[model samples]
Target: MSYIETTMKKLQRSSPGQPEFYQATEEILQSLRPLIDKHPQYLQQNIIERMVEPERQIMFRVVWHDDEGKVHVNKGYRVQFSSTLGPYKGGIRFHPSVNASTIKFLGFEQIFKNALTGLSLGGGKGGSDFDPKNRSEQEIMRFCQAFMTELHRHIGATVDVPAGDIGVGKREIGYMFGQYKRLNGNFEGVLTGKGLNWGGSLVRSEATGYGLVYFTENMLQAHDDSLDGKRCLVSGAGNVAIHTIEKLYQLGALPVSCSDSTGTLYHEKGIDLILVRELKEQRRSSLIDYLESHSDAKFTPIDQYPKDGHAVWRIKADAAFPCATQNELTLADAKALSENGINCIVEGANMPCTADAQAHIIATGMHYGPAKAANAGGVATSQLEMAQNASMIQWSFTEVDKRLQEIMKDIYQRCSETAIEFHQPCNLAFGANIAGFRKVADAMLEQGLV
Candidate 1:
């Protein structure tokens, strides 16, 4: 067997039951075949083995009380994946699905994602399996405090600084920040996604979505096309999906569909961004609430979805952005999208597409943007927040956004140029994996064994 294959077997044995982490690592290793052949130095240094291992993995039990005086227990995790390039940077997700497997995958993906940004960031991820969906504010605040009470010890502004993901947001970050301050008695930029009045940076909330669209525009502009009048399919009703819809509208594209955990929404007339913000950001209701406004729109619940694939990808569109969770788009979904002539598939969520799905899209010559490169905007903006915090300053919305746009363009160039260099032009997944890995691997080699 090949070295990459051997490494995969060893990882399976070492990190058992971590399929998501393995999937992510496998994708990168498989894509690096060409690069490994070109430069055997990385292999000689055994960078693959060292790179896959985390610097530190902390798991703790969180005990918090609800408003009703009932105690709840949840498992908290913080995986410091890497600090080779700079400080560890990623997000802390609060969802029922969080575990070592999920966080490891996210942190592994973040290592390359941060590298693609060309920023001084390493990789880390933390979270708890505390479902925050219907919890009261008091309960959430209590839980956030408990989670951070332990997480604060392993993280700092110069060490591992986490941002928000999935169920964790501004309010959660605020509670955690307060707890961190009370414990350490030192106020610092230990976390991103803080409230605007605090040490937060402008354009941070909209960075990932705006950056995804900017990357897509760069991809299209390279081929003499644009997002003008293009129809889009966006999945997920969270921050990334919501902002992606907003920026797609700004770029003259009609984001016709968006999905939540419960169902999928398809409005041929275009999604109402204002209503989406109200339902998701404010009310936190299901997409079914949207049909009350437009009877012509279609809603597909999870139970009624096609057995082969998700209902969202079956719709016809010019481009598709799977901004939901990992492994959302399967091979069937990719085939359905291709049948509908959806030529561009840019991932806004980490490892959103299945291996077969991603391979199929790229093999079909689709203008594909991998999540590590496409979704690096959020983390890049987080680094900008770090800079602002260290300097005790913040930039205006326009200024931060301009820099974000430029960064997206630069990332697109790096991926596309690397693809051409490797004789795999337009296969951005390969390009991104190679480019991101090379940077981290080189840094790891120079930094010596840790």
Candidate 2:
């Protein structure tokens, strides 16, 4: 067996029951055969073995009380996965799905995703099983305060910084920042995704979605195609999907569908962005609420979805963007997309596609943008926010967006060029994994064993 295979088997044995972490590790290791052949020094140094392990793992208890005076307790975690490149940087996801395996998988993915940005940021991820949905503002504030009480000790501007993910957003960041400031008695860039009046960067909210579209545009342009006049289907109505639809409209693509946890909403003419934002962002309601205003749109609940696939993927479209949760697009969903004639697929969410589904899509010769490369925009802009905070200079929206565009373009070029160099042209998933792994592996080798 090869060095990568041997190390992967060992990882699976050691980290048993962590299917998500194992899945991510296997995907990257499988794509790294060429790198292993080219650099025996990496194997000699045991880089793969060390790289699979985190530098530190922190778990704590978060206790808070709701407005009704009911006390609650939840587990919190922060996995400082790697610091080969720079300070540990990633987002803190707040949802019931948060766990050791979930955090480890996300931290592991962030290591490569941050590397692909060509930015000076390492990898880490943290969160709790605290679901923010349906929680009152006061309850959320109490939870954030308690969560930051412990997190504040482990993070700083130049040490380890966290932004937001899933259920964590501007409100959560604000509450956490307030607590951090109270504990430290100082204002600093300890976290990104802050309110603009404080230290957040412009376009930070729109970065991931816009970057996904930007990367897709680059991919299409490379193939003599464009997003103009393309029919697109997007899943999730969160910040990522919302901005993705906005950018699609800007690029002359018609986004016809968006979904939430409850169901998928399909509008044949085009998605009403204003209504979607109102339903999701402002009201924190389901897609079913969207139909209250626009009765012409169709809403298919989760139970009504096809037996083998999601309703979003069942809809015919020129491109598909899965911006929901991990492993959302199954192999059956990929077949449905291919049969429905999806020309390209880009992931706005981390690891939204299953390995089998990803392979099936690639085998069909569709343009596929892996999450590590496509979703790096959000973290890239977060780093930009850190830069602004350090300098005490807030840039305008146009300036920050221009820089984001340049960075996305540069990342796309690097992935494309690396794929060609490695004789895996147009195989972006393989190219991204190889490209990201090489940089971190070389850095680890130079720094020696920790």
Regions of model 1 farther than 4 Å from truth:
none
Residue pairs in candidate 1 whose N, alpha carbon or C atoms collide under 3 angstroms: none
TM-score of each: 0.99, 0.99
Give per-residue CA lDDT, model 1, range 101-195, as digits (tens). 99999999999999999999999998989999899998999999999888888989999899999998889999999999999998999999999
User: Least lDDT summed over 10 consecutive residues: which range in candidate 1?
Assistant: 148-157
lDDT of each: 0.94, 0.93
Candidate 1 achieves a global lDDT of 0.94
Tell me the tens digit of each residue's lDDT in model 2 across 97-199. 8988899999999999999999999999999999999899999999999999988999999889999999999999999999999999989999999999999
Task: Give me the runs in candidate 2 sitting further than 4 Å from their true place.
Answer: none
